[model samples]
Target: MNKVKLAEGVYYVGAVDWNLRDFHGYNTPGGVTYNAYLIVDEKVCLIDNVKAPFAGELIERISEIIDPAKIDYVVTNHVEPDHSGSLPVIMAKAPNAKVVLTEQGKSGIMKHYQTNYDFMIVKEGDVLALGRNKLHFLPLPMVHWPDSMATYLDGEQILFSNDAFGQHVCSSMRFDDEVDIDQVIYEAAKYYANILMPFGKLITKALGKTGQLPVRMIAPSHGVVWRKYIPQILAKYEEWSSGLTKDKVIIVYDTMWGSTDQMARRILDGVAAAGVTAKLYKMSVSTRSEIIAEILEAKAILIGSSTINNGMLPTVGGLLLYLKGLRPMNKLGAGFGAYGWGGGAQQNMEELLKAAGVAVQPGLAIKWVPDAAELDRCFQFGLEFGKSVLAANK
Candidate 1:
């Protein structure tokens, strides 16, 4: 628990959990923070709510500073349960609180919670006065969700970014100036890759429109608030929003015996020799979501599977199907594997990649056991593919 005074009466009251591990199945190596702010002015307003389990902690923090009943407004920055799961309980305590949100946000809340509460529907540029401070609503639908909107506090120069520019990172420090920069950036990238990668175009457009606004602090729904390095994060978002990726290769495979795994390792070695970053993930244990995140970031993806009953391995087949549906852009794809009786999985993966509009490289297939000669050929093929990807990018 921590509080940061942005303006005379405006404060950021949020819970930081440096020990958080699992966030909706996506790994949070750096932990996460649930941020909520309180504006104590002529008409008190609370911006966002912590998770339900932490509701008592939030109430205690507010009670220590001011009475909860005195709160006149509750700003539902997002209707997602992580931020709004505790709303019912909080509103029960502050009965006079009017929930401030957009029309879409109101509909989302009712749909998710099955409650009809009084809501003040706001559009872009709409302003609400809180005596000394002013709240301006900016509608940013599909920045990630249809109901997502941001509130900018005029006097404090803080933009209450609901989920945009946020990371699932927990830290004792409340601002970027006080936290480790590299850790925050890595977590931020993971968050974007997992959560916001699909909305790249919308994010680009939103950033362009919001770039003109004067923002001194970025108070996101999750993670520490951005105080000094707002531009740094904004620039990163802009770069990621462009859907640009580095020259890298990912070899994903599932093996019946050790043959397929051996082929994957050779390909990885070739990729490294070609001066590209390469990563390996076995489909047997890796989650599809994690692979999708990597797929969204990598320049080239190599898929491999042993043929089971003249078809691709079940896990690899499912991944190929998932990748096809995602329709990742600007990707060079290839396949590799080993088979005993009938070798077809490698060819099948290549066809799937082609069907999904990926630039397919000539796939490599080997017998049950790849001899030294076959391994050398596969490695050379991988090297050629890596160079081709870099040349294409150039």
Candidate 2:
């Protein structure tokens, strides 16, 4: 709520993730924020705009910091609506301001707004002079989208890092040092796992390019600014981008009569017997987005379902479909299910998980309920699954 100056003339004019309810139908287990920045130089610049609802507040912030008319340039690092939804409104206020972006970025803006505004297109490494400061644009395609780019402000030594190196957190203070480091890191990893895991390799390449630049401040579009802890956050990004993970197991399941849930608990018992960290989540009550976020941190993902008319449970099927499309990185998987008459839901889930890039183990299915022997078998399978996950991490 308060504007804190990070550098002499540069302030964090972004909103915090306060009470943001949901993200893409996924429950925000941790609330999210849409971050925007304002850079004050001889030619005043705004790096990305906030969400539509916060447009008026952002305009007020700009007015408080400097004369709105003095804003000479607007930088669009990403064309995603959450980052650029207020672009039209902001441009209307700063009538003389020139919108700056990459060629793809420019196209994206045109597509989103359907207006042919005069714009300046910069390629990777292209520089624009702003009196004492120089802004360099780096093209980062598919780090989430094709129209994304990162900006480096010369002399200030800050990187306007769009959505990379960002987290979904809300706090009164705006810097990484201001927030609890452990909490920030956890949310950051969860953010990456849900939003950026598909682009891990591209993130690594982007980080490599960023490493070559002189960056003292790392400002992103979604969370706290990284000023003093730049190196530490960058290191964490490199580690996450490297496909690194922990030896943990996630059992995701959906059941009609609690049969599959019983099996899931038995599997956890087996996993604990094997000396592994295992977490259980019900697909009916748990959001798939949160499960995917946890899956990003896990070495193994175990799925279970109940058959409905010879097909997998609807929710489990839907989740598997989503997972297959996301192509999350670095995990093994196993599947199980309970069926009444005739079904291969567990096998179907296993095939889908394997198609989604998970190294799967042999799945187990049961007729009605798991007898003591079957439960014991499920436990043993859980132990084997845990061992498989640990082995993969090695």
Best by TM-score: 2
Question: Could you list the CA RMSD of all candidates, in the order they appear?
Answer: 2.5, 1.6
lDDT of 1 by residue, 3-78 (tens): 5676678787767767777887677767778889989989899999988888888898787768998989899978
Query: How accurate locally, in lDDT, is each candidate?
Result: 0.84, 0.84
Query: Model 1: residues >4 Å from true position, as ranges?
Result: 17-20, 283-296, 309-327, 347-357
- Candidate 2 has an lDDT of 0.84
lDDT of predicted model 1:
0.84
Q: Which ten residues in a row have the lowest lDDT in candidate 2?
A: 25-34
TM-score per candidate? 0.91, 0.95
lDDT of 2 by residue, 298-368 (tens): 78889999988777888998888888877877878888988998887977898899889998878888889
